[model samples]
Target: MKKIQLFIFAILLSSTSVFAQSDATKKADKHFAKFQFVDAIEAYNKLIEKGEGNAYIYSRLAEANYNIFSTVESEKWYAKAIEAGASEPEMLFKYSEMLKANGKYEASNVQMDKFASMRPADDRAVMYKANPEYLSKILDKGKKFNVQSLDLNSNMSDFGGTLQDGKLYITSSRNASRKNYGWNEEPFLDIYEYTVAEDGSYQAENLLDGKINTKYHEGIVSFTPDGKTMFFSRESFFENIYEKDSVSNTKYSVLHLFKAKKGSNGFSEVEALPINSQNYSIKNPTISQDGSIIYFASDMPGGFGKFDIYKATLDANGNVGTPVNMGQKVNTEGQEMFPYVSSNNTLYFSSTGHLGLGGMDVFYTKEIDGKLAPIRNVGIPINSNGDDFAFRMNEETGEGFVSSNREGGKGSDDIYAIKKLQPLCDVLIVGTVLDEKTGKPVSGALTTLVDANGNVLASKPANTDGKVEYIVECDTPTELKVTMEGYESNKVAVKGSNEEEVAVTVNLKPIEEIITPEQVVLNPIYFDFDKSNITARAAFELDNLVQVMNKYPDMVIQATSHTDFRGSKQYNQGLSERRAQTTIQYVISKGIDASRISASGRGETEPAVDCKPCTDQEHELNRRSQFFITSGGPKK
Candidate 1:
């Protein structure tokens, strides 16, 4: 009877151990779901230490690490899972994605093909094959940005450094050699400061002692342009969905923007910004030059991308306006965070969605008339194929700071400063001028420069190398027009305020002219894909052609339209004909002699550029309307 009791007790103990292990796993999974990867990793580590780990647990660990942008660790665990006999398609897909992200395109393609063959009907495989912006191909030609590790010494990770009041205010995850109650053990982050010396090195120090440095994750500190108010992100304790506790008030990550004003006794007590509260995580808050607009990164709903950057306007009464997502162009499927608006109104931020070298790279885009231009990769030195974040630029000098965990770094992550080195005005514009039909460089092409208006500024012929170099004042925006005889003119507009010089390669399409009995003059009109209506620019070109036709009153021409192979053959043929007729009608309406003009539609049958199974852009060569001269007679 005693032996039986001992056996029953052993079974009960085993059951209890299993239940504890399962609970730990559930808690880890909850943290993982909420993107609390650091916490999830710790939990998973504990489970593994208890020998309760399986291939599934390792895979989850790998995924969590990958989510936290820990590529090397993620790859290590992924390989372990594969070795553990995990043959799931998701595992293979994720491994391939990792390989592709790391620039192993051929190997990644092998895995991708295996994944595709295993699941032949999967749409992702087909999409990967047909995707123009292939992740592998783009990363292969990735430009190397210069990211040098600085020699600044701080006890903790120095990140999110901004320049204000002749001092560099930065955020650090360091504790000032004291035990503070606000110190959060779960991935603690905090704010710090440093003074910039003449030697361009930071004399780093902690800020507010332990006052502003919360126990939880706090990062990305920004001060208003006037240097009066300061804002930063704070993670707070709150109930999370994945956790089982009903009244779970334990510290979880939440982004709160705080405000503080400078006072005689250092700074006033930091207060939470009005819009920030117990709900939702917000980080990387940046104020506009005028302090009217506040931009920050958030995981809040209504964003187009994950952890998208949102902008809120502060009214005259200091009331925060509705938060608006920066839109798909600025944001992407990946996180867009750590925004810094330069004094010149250029918006600089970090993004993972755009084609970058790796991880989160710093990008800058100019805001013109409230619309953001395409985000431009800061490129080399400022950005690398690593997790580059928290970019702050000094308006007085074109120098800036970025945080990175790249190779040769002092620690897990370090703050690095980049000096423009090159003079702001010393910018080069280098590109090739190609013949639209042959795809060959055209030398001696006359490229003219103009201001934002149509006023001509400078004219230079393309050199023997088929490149044009123009030096202009970098204070104003400029437009470039490339022209050569017997080809369509090309124009590229570049804003010159912050950018040194604009480099653009122009492709000039051949002007097709038909010499016939009647005098005819017709202009080639370009359209976007699958669209019948003429664009405003195309209309402008057509107007120029109309003026030419009017100058030669007796000249008549035929408007010919064509299409690339995209839609059904019959559909393309009809669409092309309709497009040709539409052009003819538009010309006639412009007071051109109807009897002098004719229209014809020739679909994919006549392709100017024979790119079989071409890309959308290459197919555009077939989708165009041209003018064939029917006759050249005396002026009416």
Candidate 2:
């Protein structure tokens, strides 16, 4: 009887422990399912401490931490889950991303390799295989902005700042009096305002008008040029609109746009936009400078990715038109969010679909030929291996704001003030090499970029389209040199100013054009005013005549020099005679047979451009030398 009672007690104790573990697991699952990641992380961690953790619990913990951007914690739990053979294909991808976010590139690549093998057709896997060495190039990109953290940030999530009408509007979850949000255990986001001084100092931190700040989430705001109208994103809960899950009896609220009128005291007359639907989310709105259009992000049906950037036209009477997708040029098979339109109508947004430095990166696209151009990454300092979004800028001010969850922030997501160091400092030297006479592409032409000091920066051959492009640093004096066999080389000077792109056309003259039937026509040989000596430029032109003569040993040349209508007739004749002698001597010095070259002087008898009142340019044109092939010609 004693042995029976002891065994029964042991069994009861074991049953009780099992029941407790089940309760803990159930509680953690509930929190995670509700998107209460903070609470779920706590519950899952308790299970691990009690030595009852399984692969499922570990993965949940990893996902929970990842949702809140707890990089170190997420990486740890993901590693553990992966080690225990709990890695799903999606889990492997998440683990790889977490590894990259922590800067463990080698480890991330290993996980990515596994992911690619498992999901060969996934876009992420395809991107990984295509550019396995993208990290170095991303890191080497020049910094375009000097970013600094804002002092107004709280320990909670604070981001999405925009400046309008001398007030800085920011979205924040810093109100301790409000109800906690299950997403990250912080208060629900509200629109806050700060008075911005003329010198860019912030003051009078306070909540926005009660009409705009509701108990539900309110996000980034934009205003019209006249400051009489405002547009922003708000949770649908304010309108009591949500979709209920039949199984869990839970309601999901989607984000929608709202327009408000600015009254005498505060913003009022708020109304939901017509484009709002219970089926999808629409948020991160930015209005055009003229308030005629609004751009945003959404995950609506028929999109190319999880989210895509969209825009809608707005009328003066506050009516919005149908939303149109930005298309594949801007959207991809991943998340694209937080669309911001600059004063100059440039569209900037954050994306995970695009090739970036492992996380959401900001990119900008502008209209070209009435359509959106190919998007380009905004580059580093404004972006990182963390979620970077909510980019707002005033192109006139050269200042902006960006939000990021990168390391060393005071909160989950912190707002940063960005001052433009320089506008992307990359000058694109792009052009086509063409025949001078035919205007057709000169294929196989070698194009080189040279700096002011004549150092070759880059070289490339023209494509079949006769196009050659090189990216050089802005604010540097550069030149584009195009060379091809059987043609005269062409050099175009480019003044590397603030312009981002400079287009040029290199017109190459055929080598046969040099040896005309009558004259070995070189470029104008220039002599300074009242000077008979051959200048360096004049020497260069004279050498071409020598080259033509050398190519044909039997060729003899007659050179004639002329003067502008400036000096006395006798003096002009003397000057022209001396210039003619100098031109002949230059050719002789270049190994040309002195007997093969003869020269004469014409004192302004023949004028290229005849004008009663000659302009400076016309005068310079008349002061030139010409060479005629007196004998044999080039072998053609």
Please list the C-alpha lDDT of all candidates, in the order they appear. 0.64, 0.78
* Structural RMSD, model 2: 17.0
Best by TM-score: 2
TM-score for all predictions?
0.60, 0.68
Which whole-number lDDT from 0 to 100 does residue 359 have in model 2? 64
Location of the lowest summed lDDT over 10 successive residues in candidate 1: 1-10
lDDT of 2 by residue, 1-636 (tens): 000010010011111121123556888776765667789889889889999877777778887787777778889988887786675776777788778888899998899899889989777777678667767756776787899999999898888888878899998889888898776778888899999977778899989876898998888898877888888988888898877756445567888899899988889999899998877888888888888888888878998877788998988887899999999868877678888877767788988777676568888877643556446678888988888888888788778899888888998889999999778555666778999999999999988777665656667788898997765555768778777766766678886676477889989987677777888888788887788888755764565676567667899999999888887878888899999998899888889889999899997787777765799998888887888888888655
- For candidate 1, lDDT tens digit of each residue in 1-636? 000010010011111121223455888766654445578788888888999877767777777666544666777777777777666665676566566457666666677777767766554454455443444434443443334556663544556667788677765555555333221222355566778788766675646654566454456777766787777766544122111234333334455677677777656677777676454656788888888899988777777545788899976545578888888768765568888887777788887656455566777776642445545566655665457788877666766778875656665567887666543332345556888778888898888766654556557788777787765544546666776665656777765554455678788776444223442333447766677776655665676567557666767787788998888889889889988887888889899878988988897788888886798777866777777666774423
Count of steric clashes across candidates, in order: 19, 0
* TM-score of model 1 vs. true structure: 0.60
The list of candidate 1 runs beyond 4 A from truth reads 1-55, 79-97, 100-147, 154-156, 176-187, 197-200, 238-251, 315-319, 422-519, 523-636
